[model samples]
Target: MTTKEEIINRLNLQPHPEGGYFHQSYASAETTGDKQLFTSIYFLIESGNISHFHRLTSDELWYYHGGDAITIHMIHPDGRYEVVKLGMNLEQGEVPQFLVPARTIFASTVEDAAWSFVGCMVAPGFTFDDFELFKAEELLPLYPKHEAVIRRYAL
Candidate 1:
């Protein structure tokens, strides 16, 4: 089995601000307005690490590749909370792909394995300007019912 360090080194992934390792893998040359049509990356999360709560201006599509299952916790703008499991076990109710709409605050963690490897593609291409990391205290009050999960995933 490949170690997390090996995967990171092999993929030339950098430390993602949200608490994972990632390397941009693709960027379309075609532009839609001022932004690229799409962008993709290789993302990995180790067992003890969590992807912090954040929101993006563009919609993101997550694809599960290998390793452990991942649980994505999303809090929609309407104040609804949803948990999506990303894995290959269809019979066990794991989904292989999921779409997160623009401006949704979300986070992820590896489950049932030492690490997880996945891919994330964004329409309108991702930019630092489009990313917003959440502060637990500030976000908690907004989603009082999801306070526990917000506390667990927020950096």
Candidate 2:
């Protein structure tokens, strides 16, 4: 079996802005006039590290590849909190793929596993300008009901 370090080195993954290790794997040459159609990346988060709360201007679709399961926590614009499990076990209620709508605050962490390897695809591509990281202090008051989670995951 391949190790996490091997995969990280092979993919040239670097510390992502949101707290995981990631490297872009694809970027469509085709564009919708100006913007690229989509882009994809290999994302990995080890046990104990969480993907901090952040949002993107474009929709992001997550695809589970291997390793362990991850729990994606999302806080919608309307203040609804949702959890999505990404894994291969159908009987265990894990979904192989899930979509996170644009502008929704989201974070993730490996659940009871050594690590998690997944793919993230963003529509209309992705740019540093399109990413927004949340500060715990700023989000706490706004979503007080989710204080515990926000504090735990926010950067």
Candidate 3:
């Protein structure tokens, strides 16, 4: 089995602000106005670690690569909550790919496994200006019913 350190070193990934390790794999030269058409990154997260709740301006598509499955927790603008599993087991409702709509608050974790490897692509590309990480205090009032998740995943 590939270790998390090995994967991180092989991919030259750096620690991401939201947790996990990542390396930008692609950035299109073509532009849609000032923003790039798309951008991609190799992302990995270990069990017990989490990608904290964050929102982006563009939609993101995640593709599972290896290691263990990951559960993505999403909190939509209208207070709807959902969990999306990313893995190879289709029979168990695990999908190899999942799409996260733009502006949704989301987070992820690799449960019951050592680590998980995945790739993420963003349309209109991704920019630091368009990313926002949330704190528990900031989200608690808005999503009072999801207090547990908000507290667990928020920065």
Best prediction by TM-score = 3
Which scores higher on lDDT, 2 or 3? Answer: 3
Model 2 root mean square deviation, Cα atoms: 1.1
Query: Which tens-of-lDDT digit does each residue in 46-68 have in candidate 3?
Result: 87678999999999999999998
The residue-by-residue lDDT of candidate 2 on 19-133, one tens digit each, is 8799999999989756789999999998777699998989999999989898899999999999999999989999999999999999999756579999999998988888999
Segments in model 1 whose C-alpha atoms lie over 4 Å from true places? none
- Best of the candidates, lDDT: 3
Judged by TM-score relative to the true structure, which candidate is superior, 2 or 3?
Answer: 3
Native-to-model Cα distance after best TM-score fit, residue 55 in candidate 3, in Å: 0.1
Model 3 regions more than 4 Å off: none
Count of residue pairs whose backbone atoms collide, per candidate? 0, 0, 0
**lDDT by residue (tens digit), candidate 1, 18-136:** 99899999999999988999999999997677799999999999999888889999999999999999999999999999999999999999865468899999999998999999989
lDDT per prediction? 0.92, 0.92, 0.94
Worst 10 residues of 2 by lDDT: 107-116
